[model samples]
Target: MGFLLVLGPLVTLHELGHYLVGRWCGVRADAFSIGFGKELFGITDKRGTRWKISALPLGGYVQFAGDMNPASQPSEEWLALPEQERAKTFQAQPLWQRALIVAAGPVTNLLIAIGILAAFNFAYGKLNIPPVIALVQEDSAAAKAGLDIGDRVIAVNGDPIESFDELRDIVVPNPGTDVDLTVEREGAQKEYSFTIPTLVEQDRFGNEFQVGRLGVGSSPGEIIAVGPVEAITLAFKQTGDIMVMMVQGVWQIITGRRPVDELGGPIKIAKYSGEQLSLGWRQFVSFAALISINLAFINLLPIPALDGGHLAFYAAEALRRKPASARSQEWAFRLGIAFVLSLMVFVTVNDVISLPIFGS
Candidate 1:
């Protein structure tokens, strides 16, 4: 229930971006349903789009007028529509407009994340921990970088580091990559370069990943209030940082550098949502923002049956001066749906196994 509440808003906002942009581009939508299957209730606006909640309560979709179904397949009848009616269909739009409509959904998710993060930073300023080393793991990145106790980290890769957490945000995603560190010790600042080793570690749930280990600890730090400008600025930076981490995580898993088991589905998200809700609204909002960012990034993957997939087709359309043959598109979407459903089943099974009732 908690997960649905969080997910509903994010999903709705994403679809809304598509609907609004499609309208702006003169495309007519047949239905805007917040779930699949039977409709709970709906209303057709003057523009003739049916907006409703569906029984499924899982995810929502926008059915364009010329689309054969929810997957946005261009129908033969749609192709044979009268020239006058074709003007209002999605296929009639120019390549740029079609691409914009398809991309709007993911972009909306990103904007939602930035807004939530900026609000949090403005209301309660983010903490900036001092980069004073408290503990260092032997043979870790910090150890090889010649860092020691009482050494204060000044910068990473020539970028000035203001907090320990900031330093981590830069290092955590770049395992097996070299990082330059400048530290202050004994009244002198010196630079050291070291590689972040790819260390495999497991979470409490036994999900493993290859992560860059700094092998250092720090004390609690003070906080400073950020002005409106800086808050928004930091919010964008934070969003980009999360996006980078998500991309790296996906790449690592695909390349066999990280465990595939770490990939989570709805169940793990629901559990985390419940935990965050228990902590309070702030934590839950942060989690939702993270999820929104992840949704945006994931949807941008060039897989068929997703927004990115649609964009890929549009790219081909632009290049070839025509859309891919309907038969080819159909096959691509079929394979894509099969792959997605299989992944969902696998993740759901993992989620069940990770349940406390089954032994966490």
Candidate 2:
């Protein structure tokens, strides 16, 4: 139920983005589904589109006219359609319109995340912490790096930091990394280089994780209320920052700097959703926002059978002044589907073994 609460509405909205945009572009939709597999039940709307829920509740799709399936591969039957019917087929639309329709799903997820974050900022204000060291742990990274009390951290690796949160964002994911820290002490600015120490920590659920720790403390941060415009602006920055962290994490995993087990699938999402729901509504909603951004990011990857893949094909079409051969597109989509299924299996296995019952 927790998983459904978090994912269902987001998935619905994602498909709705495609459905609405396709309609606006004069493309007819054959079906709107909340999931894949056998249809549990459905209702045909006045416009002749069947809206239904399916057996699988993990994801959803909108099947536009001329689409052979939810992935939006063009149907061979479309070419044989009458002139009037062909006019309403998705494949008959201009390249720009086709691109827009395919892109809408992921873009909507991004907008939802931005709106949720902006609303939180407007309601509860934002954290404002200056990057000044109040204490340095004995024999710790900061101490070994010659950092002392009252040292104001001015930058990390030449990037100016305004708050302690920003400093942590840059440092935490980079365990065992040598970083250049610029600080102001006694009105003099100097730089210090040190390797951030790796620390193993556990959450309330006893899930172990590793993070880089500088072993420095800061004063309690104040919260400043933001105006409506500022709230939205800050939300955008926060979203971008999260995206950067995600990229860094993926890179670390690829480079063997992070564990492969860190990658998760549906089971992990369900577990996380339940855990966050237990914490509080705010935490759960915030998790949803994070997932929304993640969904958008994943869909935009240039893999065949995804929104990004469709867009990639459109780009190719634009460059070559014609669509790719139907045979080529068919093979690419088949390969994409196979790759996605294999990844799902791997992550599901990973999720199961990592459970407490499995002694991870």
Candidate 3:
């Protein structure tokens, strides 16, 4: 599956974060796997960690010695280990150290994304697309607001705009909402406040969604090369901007502004992965970068059976000076696993139904 291809490397790197951090905190890993199911090939490293590739290519995990299994249930062998060996176990580590190990996974995913985007910007430079309007649609929001071709967008919501994409970064998500836009025409700057209309558009992949349309288009703009330092700065801002948009998008979906069906799971990702592959290496890499950030954000959520969830427990441990009872942790993890599995099943079925073959 296309999702598996992207998921393999991303997930492996995620687990690697846990493995490396655990080792740094004096915790030993039982295994560092690249995938799930039966092991295909494996070798015990010098550190005595079994590193392996598994049959399923979807995702992976790192198992720390003396730590509870995925279900938060303790392992018998882990419990049976002598006190000296158990001292180096993940469960025996200081609470802060345990927290660091869990946090490392999501942080590493974010780092991978930043590195990828930084490389692209440093190499190809960023497109310098000015906000100069080349076309205006009649009976649209811009037309209604007396916007004309040749008008250049200077600011949106009082924030100065650097590129047309920046203008879009403000407007696209605000469908049917009023915004304050400043434009320059004939050497004079004027402000136009208008309400954007909902524009329902379909992509080449047959996904349909509604977004705010400004009713203005621009011709191809120049590409401006930047020095290494500036490229990294821009890359950071770009990555941060996209992350904010993602969080906003989720909020919109929860508030009923975006469709519930638009919530994608693995199936949608697999389809997009294939499409990106056909587009060329650049687009495929971009997709992977986006997925990387998505993975980081998702894992950081305070849900049960997730890194964020573990971090939440650590936070509690810090306050109480003691960990939660074993029974409570077990119950919490069990409920978290059930919720995650049910959500996956629901989304996978939604993905199948949304396929073009179904015509639903």
Candidate 4:
């Protein structure tokens, strides 16, 4: 129920983008639906748009005028109509307008993420953890470099260290390399230099990688409140940071630094959702935000049977000054469906293997 609640809002927001943009572009939306298949209940709005709640809560759509055909082809009746009559037809719209309408869905997801983060920040304030060294391993890089516990990290090289996250970001990739660390101890501040060891560690999916380690951890700090502007700025920065992490994770998987088992299916998501629900609403919201971002990013990939796929075709049409053949389009769609199904199967297998579902 919690998963559905979170997912429903995200999905509706995404489709709402399409509907709103379509209407703004003078493309009549026949149905602004919250779900798929048979309608449970609906109302025809003043603008003649059928707003519907359907059986499937997983996703939704905005069916446009002149989209009666299965292939969404422009009907002869539409084509034969006067310019004023055809103005509302999606096919009759300029390419840029069509592209904007299509792009709006993903853009809406991003905006939602930003809004959620900003609201959360404003309500709960930002928790800024200072980079104070809490532990140092015996004979490790920090120990050998004469760095003691309780040393507060002020900066790395020339970059100011606001938090441990920032410190980790600067230090993680450059293993076995010297870095300048500005530290504060007692009443005095001094610069301490150290070379991080190439410590090998396994990822969440059990693939190993060598990363820089000074064998020290940081102390946690108290939460501090900020104004609306700072909160929004932090929200955007957090979003960008998450995007960077996602890109790095993908690159790691591609480079065999992480296992493909890290890739999850619906089963994994359900398990995570349940676990996160137990943790409380904040954690659940965070998870949902990350999932929202992932959804937006994945939909933007140039794969067939997706919004990006349609956009790609539109681009090709714009370039060639002609649409692809119907047969070619059909074949591409079929291939895309097959690819998606195969990927689902593979990820499902991974999810099952990773969990104790088959255990007695």
Candidate 5:
């Protein structure tokens, strides 16, 4: 129920982008349906738009006026009409307007992410931690090197350490290698060189690896309240950071640098949603935000049967002063559908194999 509640809102917001933008462009929207298949309920609005709730709750659609067939084709009947009446048809609109309508879905998802992130930052303030030392493990590398608790680490290997995250980045990879640390203890500055011990640990992605273990923790810093403007600014930065990470992951996969075991599908997502739901609302919301971003990015890829594919076709038409041949367009759409279906099957199989159901 919670997952549906979360996913429904995001999906609705995405489709609403198409509906609203189509209406603004004077392209009549015949049916604004949430979900698919059998209609559970529907009503005509003042503008003669049929707002409907369908049986399938996964996603929805906006049917434009003069969509030739129930399958959403270009209507010859509408095209044969007088020029003035045909102006409201989707194909009749300028290419730029059509492109905008197509692009709006993914843009809405990004905007939704930014809004959610800003709200989260505003409510929670921000988690702040300093690079100051709190505890040094006994008989550890620090202890063997004459480093003690209460020593404030100012730099690592001559690089200024501003946050614990930065310090961890320096320490985690170079296991058993000595790193010079400049510290301030008892108001006196001193440099200590120590090597981090090697220990096997599992990462969040379920990959196990050996990494340096310092057996030290940082001191907590004061939480600072951010103004609305700062919060929004940081939110955008965070969003961009996440997008970068996602793109890198895709690149790694494509280059065979990352294992395919990390790939997941709808089953994995549903399992994750259920697991996160047990943890708390905030955790689930974070998961949803991440998934929403992924959806937006994937939909924008220039593949057939996708918004990007349509926009690409529109671009070609604009440049050549004519649309692609109908036969070519049909074949392209069919190929795209096959590719997407095959991908879905592959990911679904992977998900099932990785789950307890398959006992793998």
Candidate 6:
């Protein structure tokens, strides 16, 4: 139920983005579906678009006119339609229009996340903590880096640090990376260079993850109210920060700095959804916001059989002043589908192996 509750609305909103934009561009949609596989039930609207629920509840899509399938690959059948019908088909629309329709789904997901985060910022204010070190763990990264209690962190690398969070933002995503820390100690400014250490930790459910830790503590921070504009701005900043962490995490995995088994799929998502839901509404909604952003990021990858893939093709079309050859596009789509399926299988196996029952 938790998984469904979190993902259902997010997936629906994502497809709604494409459907509404397609309609606005004068392109007809054949179907709008939540989930995949055989339709469980549905109704065709006056415009002939079937709105339905499907058996698989993992993801959803908007099948536009001229689509060969829900991924929106062009269909040969549409080319044989009457002139008026062809004009209303997605494939026949202007390139810019088609691009807008395809891009809307992921863009909508991003907007939803920003909206949720902005609302939270406006409601609860922002945490403000000084960058003064109150405690440094013995023999930890901070101690080894020559950090002492009462030292005031002035900057990370070269960027000025005003709060503890800013300092952490730089360190956390960069585990094992050397950095120069500028601090004010007594009456002098000192610079220290050292590598941030990686700490392996587990949550209440014992799901393990690694993060960069400096092994320092600070006094409790205060929450200060922010105005609407500032709240929105801060929300965007927060979103960008999260995106950077995600990119770094991926890079770490690719570089072998992080283990491959850490890559999770649907099962991990379900586990997290349930865990967060049990915590409280606030935690659950925050998790939903994170997933929303993740959906947007994943869909925007420049891989075929995704919104990003279509956009990539459109970009190539824009450059060449024509679409790619039909045969090449078909083969590319086949390869993309295969890659996606293989990735799903690998991540599912990883998820199962990481489960408590499997001795993870």
Tens digits of per-residue lDDT, candidate 2, 1-360, equal 789998999999999999999999999999999989999999999989999999999899888888765445567576678999989988888999999999999999989999999999999999988999998999898998899999999999999989999898888988888899999999999999988888888888677777999999899999999999999999899888888888888888899988989898999999999999999999999999999999988898898988988899999999999888888888898898888889889999999999989888
Q: What is the lDDT for 302 in model 6?
A: 85
TM-score of each: 0.87, 0.96, 0.90, 0.77, 0.75, 0.96
Q: What does candidate 4's lDDT look like per residue over 212-308, in tens digits?
A: 8888887777889989999999989988877777777677677776568778877777777777777788988888888788778767767776678
Q: Name the lDDT value of residue 59 in candidate 1.
A: 79
Which lDDT tens digits does candidate 5 get at residues 1-360?
A: 655766788888888999889989998888988898999999998877899999977678888877664223466797687888678877778779989998999888888888888888888877677777788888777777777778788899898877776677667755666789898889998998777787768645453445677878777777778888988997887777677767766775677655565677777777777777777889888877877787778778888787778888888889999888877887888898789879888988888888765654
Model 2 Cα shift for residue 355 (angstroms): 1.1
lDDT against the true structure, each candidate: 0.86, 0.90, 0.86, 0.80, 0.78, 0.90
Report lDDT (Cα) of residue 138, candidate 6.
95
Off by over 4 Å in 5: 68-75, 128-219, 317-322
Q: List runs of model 6 lying over 4 Å from the truth.
A: 69-75
Instruction: Give the per-residue lDDT digits (tens) of candidate 1, residues 1-360.
Output: 779978899999999999999999999999999988999999999999999999977678888778775346557787789888888988778889989999999999999999999998999998978998988889776777678998999999999987899888877777877889899998999988888777777755454556787889888787889999999999999999899888888888798766676788888888878877877888789999999999899788878898998899888888899777778888898888888889889988988887778865
- Name the TM-score of candidate 3: 0.90
Better of 4 and 6 by TM-score: 6
Candidate numbers, best lDDT first, in rank order: 2, 6, 3, 1, 4, 5
Off by over 4 Å in 2: 69-75
Query: lDDT at 223 for candidate 5?
Result: 77
Better of 2 and 5 by TM-score: 2
Alpha-carbon RMSD, each predicted model: 3.1, 1.5, 2.5, 5.0, 5.7, 1.5
lDDT of 3 by residue, 37-128 (tens): 99999999888899999987767888888866653445677789899999889878777888899999999998889989989998999898
Candidate 6 lDDT over 34-94, as tens digits, reads: 9999999999999999999999999998888787654455666766789898888888888
What is the Cα-based lDDT of residue 272 in candidate 5? 72
